[model samples]
Target: MEVILARPRGFCAGVNRAINVVNKALEVYQPPVYVLHEIVHNTHVIRELEEKGAVFVEQLEDIPKGSIAIFSAHGVSQAVKERANELGLRTINATCPLVSKVHRRVSLLNKINYDVVVIGHKGHPEVEGTCGHASGSVHVVSSPDEVQCLQVNTPSRVGYVTQTTLSIDDTAEMLKALRRRFPEISAPSRTDICFATSNRQTAVRELSKAVDLILVVGSKNSSNSNRLREVAQKNNIPAHLIDHAGEIERGWLDKARRIGITAGASAPEHLVTELVAWLRENYKVRTVREMDGVDETICFQLPPI
Candidate 1:
């Protein structure tokens, strides 16, 4: 089997900064640094950090008073921040700058009297947080069907935003449905979906051309990772989204002479390395090369010292 690696895979700038902030906070401050959510959604990354005394909490009240608290890369609503402040928590927000842009857009829309329609999975932490900002101004729509059946208090004044880690095709379809229903609805001039999500999907489309099977390394709950797998399958490539090497059955890949490997932005590089080593030892893996694509250099700065 030959392996084709996808460029711009694993640990996007946002995830890097969030994880680093937690570790660095642990190093700089006292033990048991608290995080609002999974720093990035990878179980391995979270477990490793948890071992270092980073506490993950869903509620601000759960965190000890006066503790050092860091928000996840997925970003949080102003309500959470305000509550944290009320509790005297030292805030170290590691929200990805791209996501921060979405929050600002929602904030601006609310001020302008535009009701926001967020296209994302319900109960997703990112969706929940973004919704918090536009509590009275926002409504959630998941699938294109939801858009068709969706009710709006003011369709003309409707604006749409999305979770950064959504399937491009699926979201486009949802947007089309929205536009059909609300002809006057406005969309973001700049995409809130972030560059990394687009680049990874583009790379996977390329991978599907030469490879018969594609492997996406990411957690089950990871939206972006799931989108990568879906994008490959949509292109008629047999694909599987596995969390690690243990999930690789080898049976599914037996017929594949060329296999493509890509990880979600929140996934780690080491997981890819571990899978490659396993393939090299067991399968007759002979060739390996990275499929070229867009160059990514986006970075989010650490919170003020």
Candidate 2:
């Protein structure tokens, strides 16, 4: 058996910055630093931060007044920011710059009287946050089919923004449908999907061709991680998404000559190493290598103290 790893697989710039924000807060401020949500979607990362005194909360009311609070990398809606101010919390904006860009774009579109449309899954924290940025008529659609059912106030003048974690091919298809339905609909100068998400998916697409089964290491709730698994499966390669090495099933290895491993943007590299170690111990793994792919150099600056 051979194991092939995907390049540019884990810890995007935004996730790195968000994790650092919590670490710095722990060092600079007192204990019980409040984080609005999971700093990133990985359970291991959250557990590690929790061990270091980070308190993760879903609502602002749960946090004590005047305490230090950091927003998640997923970003927050305008309402969340205002509520934080109303509660006298010392807030740090740890929203990923790319996600922040989408928020700003949607807000600008709403201000100019253009009916806004956000392409993302319903109830996702990022989707909710992006939608909260819009003040006027806004709609959220996850599929091209949903685009046809939209009842916009001004169909002729609509603008759209997308979640940063979505599959590029899926978003492109939805965008095409939106344009077909609303001839005057406008979109951002570039797609809203983050560079890290694109790079990871590209790497997976390349790796899928050389391996028999693909194992994606990430939490189930991770959107970008799910997309990576789907990208491989869409190419007719068998794939599985697991949180860690423990979730790996012996059945997945049956008849598989080569296994490919990839991690999501929020996943830690240590988990990948553990998976490889497990493979080496259980199977007669002859060769383990990383496939040639993009070397991501992008890094986001930490939030101001």
Instruction: Give the true-structure RMSD of model 2.
Output: 0.8
lDDT of each: 0.88, 0.94
Worst 10 residues of 1 by lDDT: 146-155
With candidate 2 superimposed using the best TM-score fit, by how many Å does residue 298's alpha carbon deviate from the native? 1.2
Model 2 worst lDDT window (10 residues)? 296-305
In model 1, how large is the Cα lDDT of residue 274?
Answer: 95
Candidate 2 lDDT tens digits, 1-305? 99999998999999999999999999999689999989899999999999999999988999999899999999999999999999999999899999999999998998999999999999999999999898898899999999989998878889999999999899989989999999899889988999999999999999988999999999999999999999999999999999999998899999999999999999999999999999999989999999998888888888797
Task: Show the colliding residue pairs in model 2.
Answer: none
**Clashes per candidate, residues 3 or more apart or on different chains:** 0, 0
What is the clash tally of candidate 1?
0
Which regions of candidate 1 fall more than 4 Å away from where they truly are?
none
